[model samples]
Target: MEFFNNHTKLFITAFLLFAGLTLLVCIIPALNNQSNNAPLPMAVPLSDMAIKGKGVFIANGCVGCHTQQVRNVDMDKVWGERPSIAADYADIHRTDFWRNTATLMGTERTGPDLTSIGTRQPSKEWQLPHLFNPRILIKESIMPAYPWMFEIKDKAQPGDVVVNIPEEYLGGRKGKVIAKAEALELLAYLQSLKQTKLPSASPQPAFLYGKVGEESDAKPGATKELNGGMLYTNNCQSCHQQNGEGLKGAFPPLKGSKVVTAEDPELLVNIIMNGYTGREKEGYPAMPPIGTNNRLKAEEISAIMNHERTSWGNSAKKVTVDEVKKLMEKVKVKAK
Candidate 1:
């Protein structure tokens, strides 16, 4: 007993020493700014909305359900661009280095990863309506209403107020109010969800090439001459016009547009085959996947696009039926 009591102090001293050493190993460099010189690579700055939405995202605990990082194999199969990298979070500055550590790193994801939500769903109006009430858009969603973050304003007043009343209440019923800034911020964060370098591959058809464009770049042949002016008058002139000056802001002006006149003819071919719609900058009322007459073959789409490209001082190479067929296959594969 006497010996055991005597060694208690030694035992305590040894334990304390070990703990102190562990603490030093963890804390010493952090306290002394040892790795502070290793700066993160710069990324594009977030919009004001995105910055605000990030705060809302943190506040509402969306991370409890959704994840940001995606695995490489899953991303490849989904064709979801690159996998999550720590560098992707370089722009996400946080005040407390400790509390915000995961924000700067990553967290465990439970729901479908949000790594590409921005590009997947880019319409601001869609996002706004979706946030006001998720069930309105996604009938099966389990998310709670963020009504507190929105305003209730009357449409009758026609003021500068943004409201969050249910769409049903728009018929002159007194509306509830919410904060526009908060909604805008939440959208900003959602819009920041895209994480890819090439959301859309260049508009080349794949069959013209031996394989998919991503797999190989084998170019296709020149298009065959067809009755382009008659085709335009009968089909395209209604929307695209005889001169190819489409409805400004509604349909794109094909005369000198980048997609039509690029050095690569694939750009024009892909659009005709797939049809597209994005931001105003991207073009609107995207050409229908099927032609206006609905039976225009791959050769027809190619000839028309090629003729348009050359007719308006476009100076780009022409598209061909084989290229159109190739891209059609690629788009179909991607759609799958």
Candidate 2:
């Protein structure tokens, strides 16, 4: 009773108890977790360029919009092959001695999860314009452009990599848009943001195991019909959009596009099989070869063409698989 009445003793006792509880509850557990002691997988080490690019990513507030962590949920299946584990980020370290900006496992998903962006969207051709003006590729994208990271040169010098930006997006500025060193570095960092394949000893998640032989016996026509909508959503909807009314001054609308309604599908087929640039006059960014990059089959390309031509108020003839196959063969022969 006397001790309870002593104010100094009570204060000391309370302080000590609180500090002990904090140490037990917070500090001890954190120190004891296996994540703290786990060995970093050797595969995902950051290169010198990637390290500098990570700094640029932090400086540009990319973490504010994009998340590196993919949650263990069905919704996240689109973002990565598997849900992210803490081990996935074991290799990431603090930016400097002064700051604790270690892993950029951002909370907000204002943009897409970048955990597997390397595999999802690997092409530098697509990445450059998307960084410069996301609207050029994604009609409704609110992502800000980093034009300062690039420069307009009258002509690219030897050894300079030119960005395939359409002149319309350049605001009629003359010359080629070349990515600066910083831009290349930033790209390197982005390309490095891939999920590392877990070792065989690690227990694999159920969602990571894809259904085997699901399409092995699928008929060509049936397969095309089945995959058409999904393929469009995955590959085309980003720019052309679901409604197919592409962004003004950036992406040409597919709703009433002449290309979609053309009788001769040769040009369109070639464009898909290869790629198309220099369409600045039509007020659209250059289209990358979705067929080549995504490795779409002849039937798949026909399916996409059929979907685009039939939908969006443009009633063009359905593109045949034979036609697409012939065109692809021609392209292959030309390349050889």
Candidate 3:
């Protein structure tokens, strides 16, 4: 009894010291950082709706099934970017709070990485439909429908169809209508998943870089190098079509176009490398800038430029590696 009573104060002091240490080491910093270091996405703000949706996301433990970070090895192999950093999370913040915790660093990868999910898929209409019911869009989706997060509504606007809500949903207490605000906020978060680069019109290889360094020129007429055809098929065909007669106004017609078969191939090479818009002299649909597909090699652009000029009735001169080199230099200067 004498020993116990004497040590009681020491034991209490020790316990208090340990608890204080833990609070300072882990709890205090987390609380401080969470209030000050959360992310604020460049695209949109965390409005009341988005905040509510974020609560829903957390309440459902979406992070347990999905991940938001991309490691260096995965980025290099899959998308060619580096891993996540603290700077990337500097967006979410408030005057008094933030959400800067190290989240989604878990063992599960049940769903795809959503770090760049918004940019990966940017269709608001598509996101809404998918959220309404996953099975409708993806037959194999294992995700449960977040019907409770949705509020079914009537046709408030013209052509706005009234979507169905599950009967047991919390939001559908009296079969409440779809809350458009919540849907938009959730979409704002999802639309931010674009992590990959855009598709190129004609991605070229390494050998196409310079003035044919001894390895240039075909082996005695090897059928005009059928290399670039595959690139064209993959990237260009969607708008240009297999026959190259692009959609009337949406995409310019490549066949029989003056720009395609012109005598000087530098213009075409520049168009491919730097991208072209405005009407061609022949008056066709304007092309978009090469914003998405910037990965095409200079040589591939040259080859495809040469191929198009020759194949489509126009006897334009072939665009050589020398020409591509020159034009690429010029484009780089202009880009600067």
TM-score: which candidate is best?
Answer: 2
How many clashing residue pairs are found in candidate 2? 0
Ranking by lDDT: 2, 1, 3
Score every model by TM-score. 0.49, 0.65, 0.46
Q: How does residue 3 of candidate 2 score in lDDT?
A: 93
Q: Which residue window of length 10 is worst by lDDT in model 1?
A: 202-211
Q: Write the per-residue lDDT of candidate 2 for residues 44-103, one digit (tens) a residue.
A: 687999888888999999999999987877667767767888777666677789987888
Q: What is the Cα-based TM-score of model 3? A: 0.46
What C-alpha lDDT do the candidate models reach, one value each? 0.58, 0.79, 0.56
User: Which stretches of model 3 miss by more than 4 angstroms?
Assistant: 1-11, 27-45, 75-80, 91-107, 149-181, 192-336
Model 3 Cα lDDT, one tens digit per residue, 52-116: 65555665687788777666552222221335554355454533356553344445778666676
**Model 1 lDDT per residue over 1-336, tens place:** 665677887798789999998789867865455344322333456777677788788788888777776555432223134555544554556645565623522365444466766754554544565566665444456767675666665443444434323546344546544457777788778877766342254232122112234423434654346666666554455455566776444455778878778776665555554556654465354354434113467766776777777886778777667877787677657646
Residue 166 lDDT (model 1)? 50
Error of 3 at 312 (Å): 27
